[model samples]
Target: MTDYQKQSPMQAIEVNNIKKSYENKYALGQPDSKEGISFSVSQGELFGIIGPDGAGKTSLFRILTTLILPDSGTASVDGLDIIKDYKEIRNRVGYMPGKFSLYPDLSVEENLKFFASVFQTTIQENYYLIKDIYQQIEPFKDRKAGALSGGMKQKLALSCALIHKPSVLFLDEPTTGVDPVSRKEFWEMLKRLKNQGITILVSTPYMDEARLCDRIALIKEGKFIGIDTPENITAGFNKTLWSVQSNKMFKLLTDLRSHPFIDSCFAFGETHHITLKNNDLTINNLCRWLQQKGHEEIIIQEIKASIEDCYMQLAQNG
Candidate 1:
């Protein structure tokens, strides 16, 4: 329900009970990736896996991209079994890992050609697919990939990934270290790709980017705590929330959490977001208490729970 209509009855991707761990250091979950990791992505839907680092986003992506096998699970990409049809799956999907994996010594144009050839295709054959992105770096065709700026490198990697015109695209933390402008431009490109009927699965650590997806899965500690549209996720919050700020911002958080009427409190940028335990006290009363604690410049404003606030609450309860 990403607001994007399904173009096909067959799912672009399907996962069931996918689980993995490294020497038990990073298990997806106790059993079945915490009651089993299962989800389906409709064709042409732009789904996002939003979480911080070490949340198993990369592990999940690697399994789907055929870069590695899951310890236990069943998955299909483009209707091809991840295990039985992995070879064909590789041919039908494009993967861009968190790090730049392109050949460092090769030129930007050369890299694109090489990836296209691996799929037994040619850049010219699918030039229309990546024309907009490639044109931005076309002038740097001869520049070595390793020598290009981070933004340019990102564009090159993306162009190469799309050169084969795969049915699905997997991007893992694609904007992790890129500049803000590049990140913005990259998302615009993804929107365009989605409009062209490509199903995109992207993961990002930026909470603010959750709104860009048709739907998002909030993963924490290797498990998905919540999955839904950004609006719905926040709307599901049942508690009363407020944003409180004071001159002593750090101390304000500590004081707010210790209050009996405050159910939960967490620092959100310049303000401390809190949910009330009950209607025992009003905002004016809370401000007075803060003033008693030697706080100045008090500002308390009721606000809606954001995705981060929702994530915090869900992670705590999950």
Candidate 2:
């Protein structure tokens, strides 16, 4: 087994009851925001914070990276207190914000140089750390950053973040707005980085990406609803799940919602996922009911719950 699979008790990152809030009128204006969100990342583990937009993923990243102070609670990275060891925390962590913050006018090589100089280091001194990712865009080193494609820009941003050889890397929604192929490539690069013993903490709005992390914390409205490995999370889903489809999807959702057996029904891709109060509801009965409601071409099947299903269930319960 690899070091990440060992499941040691030693924590590389510890967050204790952290809280933050914006003004009263803001979208995240809850008076008791964050309400003690806490979790830890093991050394060399690929940890993910999975949530939709406005779930406070970015706020938590900012707090952990020491870019912003929390209203209350304490956090430590590599055993260095965030408040007391702010500068040290900055040195030990590489943070790529949600938005691309690199200078658009500068070339890829220049951006790398700027970040390296800011950390008082040389790219050659730590070239090995970022070489695998940087080399893909190296041929365009002299091209302006703004001129690169979305995938290339992501690579450049990640390269700049890692030039200083940080022990922990925090990426906020790194895969957003990229093509599906680019998203796959980005996660592959993360796996390579994880193999090199770097603790990675990433946040993404995409639920499918949760499976890629060694472990994930599902967040919503500034609170963590669940935290565990992907397999465990999906296995822990106790409800009876069914995929219900009909020629009239819109009417199917409405009819299922009013069904006596259904506990919850939500759209999942092309079908509506229905959770029954009990497993006794059979497809024969469901098809007959849909037919009686003037529905045609109805289909129903028992299915396993996915990470997205678990996330939605947790969100509803919370």
Candidate with maximal lDDT: 2
Judged by lDDT against the true structure, how good is candidate 1? 0.90
What is candidate 1's lDDT per residue for 249-313, written digit by digit as tens? 98998899889999999988888899998988799999999999999999998898888999999
* Superposition TM-score, candidate 2 onto the true structure: 0.94
Model 1 / residue 112 / CA error / Å = 0.9
Candidate 1 lDDT at 149 equals 96
C-alpha lDDT of candidate 2 relative to the true structure: 0.90
Candidate 2 on 99-158: residue-level lDDT in tens? 989999999999999999999999999999888899899999999999999899999999
| Candidate 1 ranges beyond 4 A from true positions | 1-8, 31-34
In order, the Cα lDDT scores of the candidates are 0.90, 0.90
Candidates' TM-scores?
Answer: 0.95, 0.94
Per-candidate Cα RMSD to the true structure, in Å, reads 2.1, 2.7
Q: After superposition, how far is residue 188 of candidate 1 from its true place, in Å?
A: 0.6
